[model samples]
Target: MEETVANFSGSNGPDNISGTPGADFIIGLDGNDTLFGLGGHDRIVGSGGLDFLVGGDGLDTIFGEDGDDTIQGSAGADRLSGGTGADRIFGGDDGDLVFGDEGNDTIGGDDGNDTLNAGDGDDRVLGGDGDDEMFGGGNADLLRGGLGNDLAFGETGNDTVFGDAGNDRLKGNEGDDSVNGGTGNDSIFGDEGHDTLRGDDGNDKIWGGDNNDVLYGEGGQDILWGNDGTDSLSGGDGNDQAYGGGGSDSLYGDAGDDSLYGDAGNDQLFAGDGNDLAFGGAGDDFFQGHDGNDTLKGQDGNDTMFGGTGLDLLLGGAGNDTLAGNEDADLLRGEAGDDDLNGGSGDDYLNGGTGEDQVTGGAGNDSIYGEEDADRLVGGDGDDFVRGGAGDDVVLGNEGNDTLRGDDGNDALIGGADDDMLSGGNGNDELQGGDGDDTLLGGDGNDTLSGGEGNNELTGGEGADQFNFDGGITTIVDLDLDLDVLDTSSVLGLDTALSILGSTTVVGADLDILGGDGSLLTLKDVTILDFADFLGIDIDLLNSDLGIISG
Candidate 1:
């Protein structure tokens, strides 16, 4: 290692040459050579064969033109290349441009914001620090766009990639491999394996290329797709949008107001938080709206869905599905098939759009509508409004003040708690008002009305109707004794006719003192177990009446 100008112009053999002290130029011509640029700002070239080039200091350029070569840029802003063969190139210290051209290679743009190019074959490239750009050309390659906001290209073949820091983009053109969008808002693509990709931070968009893949949007708002095959996707935080493009896939909106879709196949989706929108298009899908206000739909197949929290809206588009609104005010619809829908709490709206469905409004004020088929609806608590449309149906207003309507067909409407309203529109129906002051109307059928307690009004419209009374004050306002019958089984414990009172009709305002709950059965009909039985009299007449009869 002395001060000299050593230039091997025709060293056709494998040569080992070293440059020293001064500004030296060491060149290796042909054969496999070892060229070291030690002191001065040196220029070392491994012209041919499998060569090793080392740039010691100062601004240097080392070219491994042929064969599988290794080049190390020790302490300078260097330009290193493994020209043709499978090579290893290292950029030490300062900014460097390292390229592994042609064969399978490994290139590292160590420190600084350097450029790393892995030209051909299956290669691995890394950008150490600062802003780096990694170019992966053809073949299966591993490219890491390291530190700072970096950019990496996994151009062609099955490759593995990592975008470590800052805002970066890692694109896998083809093949099955794993990729990570380390931090910052980064975009990553699983261009083709059943690949695995993660967008670690910042709002990022990731796409999975044809085949089964796993994708994760770790934090921030992200967009992910399980493009094909049976894939899995997770939207970790912030608002995210995920779509299961095809096949039987699973999508999860872990947090934030995220929107998720199970595009095809038998899929599953979880809308974690924030107001989210989810649609499971086609096939039997399972969807759950975990928290926040969410909109979910199981487009086809016999699906099962749950509206987990907040005010949620769920639709079971087709097939027989089991849909439930776990908490808060929710709107649940079982669009088709013989379905079941349950609204868990708060004020909820439930619609059994079609098919023979069983629906329940768990708590709070609820509105339930059974559009078609023989449906069953029950309102759990609070004042509820229930409508049973078409077919023979049964509806119950379980608690609080409620309103129930039997639109068509032979239907049964039962009211529970507080004051309630029950209406039987057509067909032979039954309307039973359980407690408090209630109103029961038999619209246009040979219907039966029963008022359980408190003051109530019952109307039998256009038919041979029958009225049953249990207790309290019940007013049979529109009871045509010519076409209607009063069944007082509640007092007599058996059916008894209106003639039992014997024409002594006590009109509303002309009422006098009667025993029991101080009740006036009605201005017209006072049927059922009357106060006369409690007073130990078979006939009804007051002591003030002149020809009053006593049993």
Candidate 2:
């Protein structure tokens, strides 16, 4: 047992101490005591019994006069003080300064670069490492900046802030606050109520003050600003930029080369890649150009548009409308409402002027024209051209090498591939031809034909009749009747057999006028005979392995 109380003054003895070591100057003349500065550089003082103080190394100074005290600065460079009750303080190494002067305190600046303050009730502050700065002076506080490059502040109640690594800065000064910038290169600010901001990596900057706010820019090259209420902004990668400054806002440019602006109310914009540009400056807005080579503008209220890839340009200036150009080489216009248009890929150009409109050309090589209401047109892919000008209409040319014309309604025409031509000029009509080499003309209903490939020549002129062929060719003639009247139902179903007996009527002898009922007969001249009882049915049929019919 050892005790050396140098210059120890006592007004009321036994302020509770078990101290008997060298170089000790413990002073607590009043009721509180538990002062152990057992090693060198020890100067401990607790003028009341709610105190336990230890400054075991050089450069130490500890003091807690009233109740509620625990001060620990076990190494050099320490100075802690919670002179009033309700205090717990720690500054264990070099560069320490802690003060929780009034009640409700837990303050720790546990290593070098430490300075902490929680002076009022409901306070918790930690700035434990180098480059640390923390201040939560009033009630309702919790602040942390535990690594290098740290600065945190939640000076009033209803506060929680953390800027845990290098390049950190956080602020949530009043109530309704929460902030985090937990990685390198961070900057966060939500200075008033209704605040939440996160910018967690290098190149981070976020600001969302005033009511109704939320902001996030979680990676490098980040800058998010939703400075007013009704805000949400996200630009979480490199080449990021987002600004939705007023109420009624939502902005996202989540990949590289992003620039989004919806500066006024009634706003929504998304352009998440390189070569992106979106602007919906005033109210009533919706815009999406979600890939490269995009330009969208819906500057006033009553607007909706989407042009999601390269070669995209959409503009819907006034109210009442819908427009889409979801792939390359697109241009859409609905400068006023009562409009709907889609040109979803390369080689697309669509226009639907004045109210009452609908237009579609959803693949490459497309062009559609439907200028008024009561309109519908479909021409999707290369070699498509559709024109349905006035109201009451339906027009389709669904594949390459197609041309369909239906100038007025009560109309339907389908000619969907190469070598196709369909025209139904006036009302009351239905026509179909969906493959190569097709031409169908039925300007009034009660019309039907199925000849969808080459060598298809059909004419079903006036309503009441039906003619069909899977193997095409039909002809019948009687010039006088001779050459043995060509037996076997006219030259034995001639797949190649033409016999004109006399008057030198046998032209290279190759004919098949199918009496075998395979139904393909067109023998114009059985070797040039305007003579021999003119009973002509040699019907020239040459199938020398199906070649040489080029015209």
Candidate 2 local lDDT, 1-551, one digit each (tens): 23444434334544555343454667775665666675656567786767777777666677786878888886777778887788888888777777887888888887788777777777778887877778787777888887788888886777888887788888887777788887888888887788777776778888887777777786788878887888878777777777787888888877777777787788888887767777777788788887787777776677788888787777776666678997687877765656678888778877665556677887887767776555677877777777666566677777787777665555566777676677665555565666677666544433444444444444434443222333322222221123222222332333422222223333665343344334333334454533222233233423322222221
Model 2: how far residue 199 lies from native, Å: 1.9
Estimate the TM-score of every prediction.
Answer: 0.78, 0.46
RMSD of each: 6.6, 14.9
lDDT of 1 by residue, 369-440 (tens): 998989999988889999999989999998899999999999999998899999999999999999888989
Give the C-alpha miss distance for residue 411 in model 1, angstroms. 1.9
lDDT of each: 0.82, 0.68
Clashes of each: 4, 21
Query: Judged by TM-score, which candidate is best?
Result: 1
lDDT of 1 at 144: 83
lDDT top scorer: 1
